[model samples]
Target: MTTIRTVTGHDSAGASTIISHGPLPGCEEFIHSPGFSAALVWRTPPQARIVDHPGDPAQAESVIPAPGGSSALLVTFPPDDLAGGADFDPLAAAEELCQRLPGLGERFEAEAPGFHRTDTIDYGVVLDGEITLELDDGRTSMLRQGDIVVQMGTRHAWRNRGNTPARLLFVLIGAQRPPRGD
Candidate 1:
């Protein structure tokens, strides 16, 4: 599916104007993980300043926003059964994920698969279809279209157990993890 992203910014005259309108740059379906797609929509570094031409922040190096930063992403997941088929290539898939997602991709646990954690608070909204949110304790929450989830720097993973694909939008804000008590 083509995701048309429209960006707004202030013109030289200080009037709000549409900066760009089209499919997100670099957004593509994963060849190794057929049916899966992810797009980095936007990003803002710490203490972001408003500029007349901000350009496209989606091309930034890291997907994991730094402290006080934020990022927006759109992800589509195919059914669980669709992954790791006979033609599936794990190494290629991992390489592609790391290259596309940058820091965020490295956070995924190899031992536990989808399980991962980050120092950021995320607000996720189910855009279409159904999915299951699994936490570290193995507890899961079934979510459907329009459902929302506030993830607080927790270890979690998303599972699409349904027959169809599921789409989700997430906004993540960088956060500081408090010092652990000994």
Candidate 2:
């Protein structure tokens, strides 16, 4: 699936213009994980300043934005059964994930499959198919197309139980983790 992203900016004459209009450079379909794909749409550093031409901020070294920063991501999840098939090579899959997702790939727990936590507040919207949000304690919430979720900084996993693929858009805002007692 191709996701075209259009970026607007000011021209040399200080007039608004279309800076870019094409698929994101960071978009990729996971070869190891069949039916899975992701696109890093855009990113902004802390206290991002507006510029006539901000250039392409879609390429990222890490999915976790710096404090006061933000990132927009589009992800498609395959059915749970498609994961770790008989021909699935764990090492290859890990390498592919690391290469495609960078810092976000390393966040998944090795001991617990699909479970990971980040120091950010994520606003997620289900774009297609259905999905289930599984929390640390086995709690689950079903989400369908048009559904939205405000995910705090909590350990969670996404599960696609249905046969069809699930697509979601997430906007993550970097935040500082509070003290344990707080």
Candidate 3:
């Protein structure tokens, strides 16, 4: 028979040391810009939904109740709500934001602008500047402001290819697995 030992930190580390934590708190980031802002919230439990947009550089958002888990919402502040502390929308409110400027894709860098492929499904809406898109399937498209592109499970990237620094209110929705304990 083989013998093994299981060590317990509470008894060994003494009173001053905190052995292990039961659970940890999740984190998120809020992006604020001159004309737009975004809030990102994560869940402690596993992810459940995947608004698949493969190869597209943009992310997605949702409010479905996660089974046996919780989710965070990242909202963008609206223009009118500025003084009164603008209201935020995960994406529903972010849809028509870039109606005035031209668009290319999700990410449009000033230097060396081209395709930056991704692993999951993605969605993009152009807010400003012109965009140039090239896909893995040799399909290409251009988006002006106020256009929405849904890319599900394919390789893709974006290029501003313009003189200005364009902004696309991005939302990334990914695959959500069940919690480890679940």
Runs in model 2 deviating more than 4 A are: none
Candidate 3, superposed: residue stretches over 4 Å from native = 1-116, 176-182
**Candidate 1 Cα lDDT to native:** 0.90
lDDT of 2 by residue, 59-103 (tens): 578978987999898999999998768998877887887788777
Residue pairs with clashing backbones, model 2: none
- Which is the leading candidate under lDDT? 1
Expressed as tens digits, the lDDT of each residue in 27-103 for candidate 3 is 11223223333322333234444322212212323322223333332222223224123554434222322221112
* Rank by TM-score (best first): 1, 2, 3
lDDT of each: 0.90, 0.88, 0.38
Name the runs in model 1 displaced over 4 angstroms.
Answer: none
Looking at model 1, the pairs that clash are none
Q: Which consecutive 10 residues in model 1 have the weakest lDDT in total?
A: 23-32
Model 1 clashing-pair count: 0
Global local distance difference test of model 3: 0.38
TM-score of each: 0.96, 0.95, 0.35
